[model samples]
Target: MVPVTTTQIHSRPSLTIIGGGPGGYEAAMVAAKLGAAVTIVESKGMGGSAVLTDVVPSKTLIATADSMRRASGASGLGVELGDEPARADMRVANRRLLALASEQSNDIRRGLERSGVRIVIGQGRLVGPTTVEAVTESGTEIIESENVLIATGASPRELPTAVPDGERIFNWTQVYSLTEVPEHMIVVGSGVTGAEFASAYNQLGAKVSLVSSRDRVLPGEDPDAAVVLEEAFVEDGVNLVSKTRAESVERTADGVRVQLTGGRILEGSHCLVAVGGIPNTAGLGLEEAGVKLKDSGHIAVDGVSRTSVPGVYAAGDCTGVFALASVAAMQGRVAVAHLLGDAVKPFQPHLVTSNIFTSPEIATVGVTEEQVASGKYQADILKLDLSTNPRAKMQNVTRGFVKIFARKGSGTVIGGVVVAPRASELIYSLALAVSQRLHVDDLANTYTVYPSISGSISEAARRLHVHL
Candidate 1:
């Protein structure tokens, strides 16, 4: 297929988007395809935080860490390395990850340009509800448009007392700059971001301490899955500091000192603050343009990605939604479809597929175990341990499960969770089941390859077939 030329897209559409993140870039592509001239203003390079700093870089680094973990375990599978244990050079790993992030950002830019969307590099703000002003390195450009979208994304939430200095102290973004591994790493937060980093660094030969204000790590995730991860962390020698908060983190002469609640103190070679994120909604003229924002500063948007004001919309982490790239992309598409008189559906939270990048990933879709227990939805649930799977035994994998939730009588799949190696890949089948409203019997009757982790999904569905 021939690519659309930039000249062809230069009509008076003036569809201006602030931020070149997942939400903005995806919206630009869809709008351009619909024959609308689109302009995207990005302070950072293309692909935004999800690609340039957070997801892409972190996952690339974790890949190397995972390889090291597998190598160390090869002896258990009757394989042996040389006299020395396989070590990862942090300098090499960091360089590779940053390079990959740059390449990904460049790829996103190429895609947008190929789609005939104009790229404006600089800060963007709403001059009015229907107008956007971008301050680029060259000069300022005022865009008057009937459609405007705010997808400025977010930054890591920081505490006043514990700030990231990008040296001994770091946030999620700054950790990529490390040229050497630390002897000890202290992570503050037990949620998805915190737990993921802790798991990766631990696998990378660092003594990790995961400090949590909750009872256990991943307080927002599945309890059963959390138990499996906590057990794994224990076996991996990760220090779990639960039900406490970090009062302060100060850089020491050698490393850093963390003062926890109850007057407890801990020292580490490096500290990572992963409490959460704050949307980049400030200085965007949101309120002046009559755009309502929540107390957390996230732009308030409806199911269709519309803000309080008309002709304006918001998507992605800036909206404080699911914060997944796929969800953000879909929200962007929905926004465009609504504007262009195309068929569009509201946001369906249940159909959202979420994956956590850890040793054994935790992936879930549709209704959650917590939601079910709270009587939000009634269903028959079954969990099958991977330890009992033939393929899992062959891989020497013992830490995961495939769980299915189906409604009684009808036996239609409503929710599912997979806690296993590459659960992200395994959870797609369950995602299809829940989204298509497929019945447990249908899943059970489906053919699956023998001695595979995916077989566990079919086996679990077969067990749930009795509910029919």
Candidate 2:
């Protein structure tokens, strides 16, 4: 555990947070800052899956693979790598990735402690509206609070026929324990997690196959962005099996065999299942405490993160309202503000931004093309390919584009998408415009650095402004 500096004590309103993931810890900090005495109960390590297993570990692995892929392409930039080529040591990479995950988790714990939030290593349940029962290795402890927050988070959903053995068969969380890079990896499911891992491993030099139950990868994302990624996946030697689902996964003599819905079998060194996630709400005494839950087992909460029971709120994956970590943090903060008598704004998910960290990352903010086609809003759309950007040419980036959507007559920027190497970073300006209801002319007037991918944003805005 990381050490933190303790401050002088002061009497404050009491608040308790169950689960120390982004949602729990973030809310704890907010409540503490607002002069609330905060206690966080967590069964696993701090930072939850976002740090210990799912987000941090996976992104760290992808970063290593991304660097290797960049080095392999250095020849195009007139860079030489001697006679021998670069190779990644999977054992060392996995070890470093796990270390980084642990370090980040500790950092989060320290930050919370520094904010005067008490951390408890235990499993917490809602015994009453404002009471919590924590069971630790030491013993059962009861805590009383004016407010309670449930953020137990979620776990990877597993299919009965494709249960993970944690060796040849794995879930998104278990893949980090592999001692060697899989010679071939079959990734089932085409959601954000599946697409990202599939693309990362493929670039990491694994023979990768992506099985999608939908017509294309990333069925929930922009169709144009998906098309670019699917093309790139195939060009990079990834066998994409579309409109197919994995029926079952069984270990063979040396590897694993994945049977698809159509009787097709894919043999690989390992199989990773990324179907979805199941909320961790059972046995937590939520129902007994009068907290309503959806049929899917997720806590039912309003925009301000309020549950059916007053003084008891929920956030993060457990609420099933936008699984992104950023959204979770915001939801947590909102819940704390409402509980602590601070001015609070209900969570507006439409203002949130989401990203997929694949080779050519895909990012979007606000309204989507699907929403437009659904006739919910009338908007003009514009797209500018990165190939036309001078910065992209200099960086040898041949794929991706910047797309913007604006109201037809008003020219207000409603939403946008970016597909490029650093689309995650480039989507912020568009996010700001959409959130603030800034018009296309507002973005068009903004000055962008020369020879940068961001220039495409302003350029697209200029074109949209002309039509308006």
Candidate 3:
């Protein structure tokens, strides 16, 4: 770890980063390694929403739900549980979930501290091109630096008609306070967040209704993957309210009442609003400091993460460049590399691998069928059902498929999608193949364990190669 001191501070370029999320902390570490004095201004915990509220907490809840789901199916694997059914304890699960989030937050803080990045617990605003005014618990402090990176991140957007009460009506962040499971849960907005919560709670012994304005759940995901998930949702007794918008929500004596666009009403013990998130770019003195922001209020950043101002940069959800923590970390690293005059590749959004953490996780990387269908890129496609895989039969898992895309003639692995349990782990090989420009033949020739779910990847590549 580097040591910080006043003598050495004058000898190196100084960097100040706002918001201690993955984007800010990661950049601080990188800049410190490059011999720059770095300081981080953060009002929240070190790991930001990814570790504290949104990513870690939600995934922990999902893990508990997944374990319960698997335990209930253990009888099929010859493990009988008599006649009584297993039940989930929401209080214990919530305690463990919050503990895990706090543990992760402390770990991140220690890592940044060990890397010699000065952390100021405060809200920071840009006062000049390289000057930051931080309002801390004690008092205001001014920081002068050669480079400034804004990674303030984002928060859940709320609607006026349907506000979260943190009880009957809740947002994604507020759901962690639930000590008792609801009798019936209503989830509005069938995007990734809504679908995940609906699936999780249904498996956790709650009647769930998923309301979607789109024609299908997960409208942005692979069409085939969405179909499989929708089927599983219905099978698990999750009521699917498709092609309807939630107009307003009001608390009843016992539960909540949600009014739909077409004058239909749905009642539930609780309602979770997962509409979307808004970037945390307001009141940062951005416009006054000459930092350009998009109409949506996200800081506009270039490929290297530079803002409109020469020395100012931005990353993470605030930049609206893929709202994933992995992408945020990469953008932060790129920003520091550019600041230190290192040879760096521009951040590529197309190469980012993302996953939706549902029962059958949906993982995707590179190009998509939509991109090829747009007539801009020529590509060949192949789809292989997991039902054909021996592992699927062994595990009684019959709800996923693998789809791959390649160049029309050359057959280079351009992009692919995986829908299965632990698909997040499986997509890495395909991501590496696409990023490295590996041919379909390369993947086909690679040795995969017999009777493994990953075999489907190699087999799909082989089929594509044969056709090519």
Off by over 4 Å in 3: 1-9, 466-468
Find the 10 residues in a row with the least total lDDT in model 3.
Answer: 1-10
Can you list the residue pairs that collide in candidate 2?
Answer: none
Q: What would you estimate as the lDDT of candidate 3? A: 0.92
Over 66-128, each residue of candidate 2 has an lDDT whose tens digit, in order, gives 998898889999999988877778899999999999999999999988998898898889888
Candidate 1 RMSD to the real structure: 3.9
Q: After superposition, how far is residue 388 of candidate 3 from its true place, in Å?
A: 0.9
Candidate 2 wrongly placed segments (more than 4 Å): 1-11
Candidate 1 stretches with Cα past 4 Å from truth are 1-13
* Cα-based lDDT for every prediction: 0.91, 0.91, 0.92
Backbone clash total, candidate 1: 0
Give candidate 3's TM-score: 0.97
- In candidate 3, the residue pairs with backbone N, CA or C atoms under 3 Å apart (3 or more residues apart, or in different chains) clash, namely none
Estimate the overall C-alpha local distance difference test score of candidate 1: 0.91
Report how far residue 224 has shifted in candidate 2, in Å. 0.3
